[model samples]
Target: MKFHLTVDNWTVQKTDARAVRFDVFVIEQKIPVELEWDDMDELCIHAVAYNEAGQAIGTGRLLPDGHIGRMAVRSTGRGQGIGAAILQALMAQARQRGDTEVVLNAQTQAEAFYGRYGFSRDGEEYYEAGIAHICMRHVFA
Candidate 1:
């Protein structure tokens, strides 16, 4: 199914936009519940992509420092460029917020995907809930 990506402050719709993506990431993918959510959620802006039926298939969030997180696309919907769309929307929103650098804790396996968007690794890899992750940053001057 195809999707329409939308960027919005999580508050405008709150959990309404993130529920499904979290289900895939936190439950289906086995990412720890604590790792899936954090205190920053309420303070950050969110980006969501809705499939034709209006269900969210992809989602991500941008923190105050322009760090993006929770970038997840439903397993059934993977390999369809949804993740790229989510990242693009989130970064656009971050730029609007006066941020010139966009950052994210990337799942090591997916670092290459982000690299295509001009994001480069910032430091050594680390373990987050048993999964390897690394800090990546996208800077726009």
Candidate 2:
């Protein structure tokens, strides 16, 4: 499958990002609708992945403070590097902004996925929106 990515502020890509997040985090994961959104979106940089058909398949964001969150890839797009590409794009954005490190509260089940990209566990596991998560960090070299 072929796809492309777009990086911009929420103002430019909120619709696309919101769709993927709504599907993955809200409907699919059963996370409360209210908990899936926050004021930070407008202030953060967002990235959305579009498949060959132009459907939004994945999305993620990088905050000014170098925190990464809301990473999601649609079910049909998984295992094809969509998630990795979204993550790398956000990390590159952080580096371009001169951030020394990036952090995220990764769902425990996906810890190893982030680990493959050099993110290390920073604290004990905890729960977020009823899902197990842990603090993870990756320092830029």
Candidate 3:
């Protein structure tokens, strides 16, 4: 099936971005509400993906220091490239801001997905909010 996905940059405080992340991270993944929301949110540049019907389907954020985080795509949006679109949008924002590198703590299951985007595992695996994760980084010239 094909999907008409639109990714737009927004502040983390935006409702659309918050909705997507809440569904994917907190509700679906069982991440604690406390851990799902953090102070860095206010300082990051966020991207929210919308479907043809104008529903938020995915989200991601890029911090000023080049850290990418809070990437989430709703269950209904998975396997349709929405996640990749969100990541690309954030990466573009990073590039436009003159960032030389981007880093993220990726869930172990998603290491290969980020790898396809040139992100390499940077350190040993660890757990965050009860999920196995590892640090990954992508450098730009």
Candidate 4:
């Protein structure tokens, strides 16, 4: 399936971005509504992927400090490269901002996926929002 991505601040694409995050994180993952959102959103650089039909299917964000978070793709959009596109877009944004490395607390199950993108484990696994996650980083070469 064909999809497009938009990289912008939260305020500019909040509606579409929120919908994708809400469906994946809030609804499917059962994460607490409160924990799913934070002040960081307004301060981070957001990347949202839209289907050919114009529906938001994936999203991610890059913090000012080069931390990547809130990476998500709706169930229907999994395995279609939407997540990779979103991550690549955010990584590009980080590099454009002069960041040498970008970090993320990836769900342990996804460690291999991130690894394929040149991300390596940075620390021991830990639980966040009740899910097992491990710190990972990709340093631009």
| Candidate 3 lDDT tens digits, 1-141 | 244444444553478888888888888899988888778777788777777777777788888799999998888888888888878878888888899999999999999999999999999999999999999999987
What's the true lDDT of residue 79 in model 4?
Answer: 98
Global CA lDDT computed for model 2: 0.96
Distance (Å) between predicted and true CA of 29, model 3?
A: 1.0
Tell me the spans in candidate 1 whose CA falls farther than 4 Å from its real position.
none
Q: Show how many residue pairs clash in every candidate, following the order shown.
A: 0, 0, 0, 0
**Ten contiguous residues with the weakest lDDT in model 1:** 13-22
Q: What is candidate 1's lDDT per residue for 1-141, written digit by digit as tens?
A: 678877777676466456865678778878777766667878888888888998777788888878898888887678998888888888888888788899899989999999999999999999888889999999987
TM-scores for the candidates: 0.91, 0.99, 0.91, 0.98
Error of 1 at 120 (Å): 0.7
Index of the highest-lDDT prediction: 2
What digit string (tens of lDDT, one per residue) describes model 2 on residues 1-141? 899999999999999999999999999999999999999999999999999999999999999889999999999999999999999999999999899999999999999999999999998999989999999999998
Once fitted onto the true fold, the runs of candidate 3 whose alpha carbons sit more than 4 angstroms away are: 1-13
Question: 1-141 in candidate 4: lDDT tens per residue?
Answer: 899999998899799889998999999999999999888899999999988999999999999999999999998899999999989999999998899999999999999999999999998999999999999999999
- The local distance difference test score of each candidate is 0.83, 0.96, 0.84, 0.93
Superior by lDDT: candidate 2 or candidate 4:
2
